[model samples]
Target: MKLKLILSILFVATCFVALGQEKSPEKGLIKISIMYPYSEGKTFNMEYYETKHMPMVASFLGANLVKYTIEKGLSSGIPNQPLPYLAIGTFYVKSLSEYQAAVAPQRDAFRADFKNYTDVTPVILVSEVVK
Candidate 1:
């Protein structure tokens, strides 16, 4: 009985250790998040953003971009509260420098296209994915 209990404890401890282990981070990868904050009188054209804006941005990133995701905020955790953001767009690139090199020339084009989609200024964040 003691031996069985010891074995069970060992198995459980091993399982816990495995479960608690953090996932290895993706090295040398950069994540760029473009967030549009929610506010009164702000204008966001979801259709234009999804169809036109994002695709244009992706084209600029080209081979450097691994993938991209777009999210639309519905509502806050509180009841009857306003949504925190109108939309969010995130793209993962192999490196920050590569992404910058790719987008530098097209920065003006990007800014020019923004008026077609949204009135609110976007918040940009660049971060490393460290698990």
Candidate 2:
């Protein structure tokens, strides 16, 4: 009776502790991507995005930033279809918390710089690598 209750309590406590532990990233990395979907009349400046925006992001993110990659969309599945996205920029970070902490401080500055490259708003995705 009492032993059963004690065991139940212990089990619950163990679960709580496990849940509180930090989540590990896939291959020690968490990837954050920002995508700009193509639209008529939408404009993107690839040169500014490559030369300026990424370097600024790296500078602000600092040590937490593992690396970043930028992709230029060429085409969609159909032979002559327009690309789904104008560009996709991915940021690989050490961990979710580290990335959050690093970006929080510089978020405003980061967002402000977007106008220099493109007019389209980006869709952001954060994914955990599964290895």
Candidate 3:
């Protein structure tokens, strides 16, 4: 009876360990970050980005967009170095194809809105989520 109880406890513990493990994100997961570099005398209106641009992006992209986050870059680690970017915006989506399809139609609208927010040309990075 003691042997049986020990085996049962071991089985339950193994199950719990497996359940607690972090599963990889779904296979098609993609993340895109648009980074606006900082320059002296340049302007980045964080208020416009949060209030106008993001809402427009959400409305334009609709279901293809899983979620998004915006970050304002404050300073570089070095005391005197200028910040590398004024702002960064990240978009999480299910797949590249889905994102492309959704944005293609609204491309013009997105471009037009950029002039309203910042003058810095954004550097874009697209990455697949692994692990």
Identify the leading candidate in terms of lDDT: 1
TM-score of candidate 3 relative to the true fold: 0.78
Give the alpha carbon lDDT tens digit for every residue of 1-131 in model 1.
99999999999999999988856556557999999999999999999999999998898887889889999999898999998889999998988998999989999999899899899898999999875
In candidate 3 the C-alpha lDDT for residue 82 amounts to 85
Scored against the true structure, residue 112 in model 1 reaches a CA lDDT of: 94
Candidate 2 lDDT, tens digit per residue, 1-131?
A: 99999999999999999987747554758899999999989999999999999877877777778889999998898988888999999999877887788779888988898888888999999997765
TM-score to true structure, per model: 0.78, 0.75, 0.78
For each candidate, the alpha-carbon lDDT, in order, equals: 0.90, 0.87, 0.87
Model 2: CA > 4 A from native: 1-28
Q: Identify the candidate with maximal TM-score.
A: 3
Deviation of model 3 at 128, angstroms: 0.7
Alpha-carbon RMSD, each predicted model: 3.1, 10.6, 3.4
Candidate 1, residue 15: how far the Cα is off, in Å: 10
What would the TM-score be for candidate 2 when compared with the true structure? 0.75
lDDT of model 2 at residue 93? 85
